[model samples]
Target: MCQLLGLNCATPTDASFSFTGFCQRGGATDHHADGWGIAFFEGRGLRLFVDHQCAAESRMAEFLRSYPLKSRNIIAHVRKATIGDVRLENAHPFSRELWGRHWVFAHNGDLKDYQPRLHSQFQPVGTTDSERAFCWLMQELAKSHAGLPSVEELTLTLRELLPQVRRFGSINFLLSNGDALWAHCSTKLHYLVRQHPFTQATLMDQDWTVNFAELNQPGDRAAVIVTTPLTRNEQWTAFEPDELKVFVDGLPVEVA
Candidate 1:
C-alpha cells in the first residue's frame, strides 16, 4: 500500500509544511518507502517530480522540502510496491494530458486482477495498476463527453464509474486538474480544511510547530486530504469507506 496527500487551495500555496510530515512516512515514521512522487499545477502548466528512492532518505525529497513551489491543486504519494518493481516509472502521481489540460493522479490501494481494455488514446507507460487505472478513467471520460465537462458533471461520471473498478479491490485515490481536486476512499482517508482565524499547528512526525496565523493572510484557505492526519492539533475528518469528495477553492462543494 501507499500513502496519499492532496491540497486544493483558494490561493496559490506552498506545501512544504504538510509535505515534511508526510514524507517521513516514506521510511522514517511508517512503511510506505519504496518510491515517492509529487505533482504541482500552476495555471495551465504542470510540474512533476518522481524518484524511485525512499523519500525519507532521498536528497531530491530534501531539496523539494526546501523549495517553495506554489500551486493551487497538488497531489503526492509515497508508494510501497505491490504490483510493479521499484523503479522510477512505477512511481505514483502519474500525469497525462486530457482536453489540453494536464491531469494528475495518485493511488494508495491495490487492485486484484483488474485490467480494463484501453483502446483509446490514453495508455500507461508504466506497468503499475495505478497507471493503468488512470488511463482507463481518462479513456472513459473522453468517450462520455466531447471535452472537459463541469467539475460537477465529472464527479457524477466518476461516481458511476468507480464501482466498476472498486469491485476488483480497494481504489482509494486522489486526482486533480489545476482547478478542482477529487478524492475517493475505499478503506482509509482523512481530510481537513484551514481558513480564516487560523491557529498554531504541530507536525506529527517532526518536532516543529508553525503558527499559521502569522504566515497566512485572512483570505487564505486550503483543503488537505491524506491517508492519515498530518498534524496533531488539526481536526481531521475521516472518510467513510466508499465515499467520494471534491474540493474547489479550498472548500468541499456539494454535487447534486
Candidate 2:
C-alpha cells in the first residue's frame, strides 16, 4: 500500500507543512518506501517530480520539505511497491493529457488481475498497476467525453466505474486537472479545510507548527486530503469506506 496527499486551494498555496508529515511516512514513520512523486498545477502547466528512493532518505523529498511551490491543485503519493519493481517509472502520481488538459493521478492500493484494454494514445510508461489504472481511467474518460464533461456527469460516471475498479482491490486515489480535484476512498481518507479565522496547527509526524492566522489572508481557503490525518490539532474528517469527494476552489462540492 501507499499513501496519498492532495491540495485544492482558492489561491495558490504551498504544501510544505502537510508534505513534511506525509514525507515522514515514506520511510521514517511508516514503511511505504518504494518510491514517491508529486505534481503541482500552475495554470495550464504542471510541476512534476518523482524519485525511486525512499522519500525520507531522498534529497529530492528533502528539497520539497522546504520548497514553497504554490499551486491551486496538487496531488502526491508515497509508494510501497506491491505490483511493480522499485524503479523510477513505477512511481505514483502519474500524469497524462486529457481533453487538452493535463490530468494527474495517484493510487494508494493494489489491484489483482485488473488489466484492461487501453488505446495506443494513452498507454502507460510504467508497469505498476497504479499507472495502468490511471491509463484506463483516462482512456474511458476520453472515449466517453470528447472534452471536459460537466462536473455532475463526470461524477456520475466515476461513481459507476468505481465499483468495477474495486473488484480488483483497494482503490483509494487522488485525481486532478488544473481546475478541480477528486478523491475516492476504499479504506482510509481524511481531510481538513482551512479558511478565514484559521488557528494554529501542529504536525502529528513532525515537530513543526504553523499559525495560519499569521500567514494566511482573510480570503485564503485550502482543502487538504490525505490517507491519514496530517495534523494533531485540527479536526480532520474521515471519509467513509466507499465515499468519493470533489473539491472545487479549495472547497468540497456536492457529489452524486
Model 2 reaches what TM-score against the true structure? 0.97
Provide TM-scores for the models: 0.99, 0.97
Best by TM-score: 1
Q: After superposition on all CA atoms, what RMSD does each candidate show versus the true structure? A: 0.6, 1.1
Pull out the clashing pairs in model 1. none
Candidate 1, 1-256: lDDT as tens digits: 9999999999999999999999999999998899999999999999999999999999999999999999999999999999889999999899999999999999989899878999999988889999989999999988998999999999999999999889889999999999899999999999999998999899999998999999899999999999999999999999999999999999999998
Query: What is the lDDT for 76 in model 1?
Result: 94
* Count of backbone collisions within predicted model 2: 0
The digit string of per-residue lDDT tens for model 2 on 1-256 reads 9999999999999898888899999999999999999999999899999999999999999998888899999999999899989999999789998888899999988799989788658898989888888888888888788789877778777887788789899899999988889999999999989999989999988999999999999989999999999998999999999898999888999964
What value does the lDDT take at residue 31 in candidate 2?
97
Which segments of model 2 are wrong by more than 4 Å? none
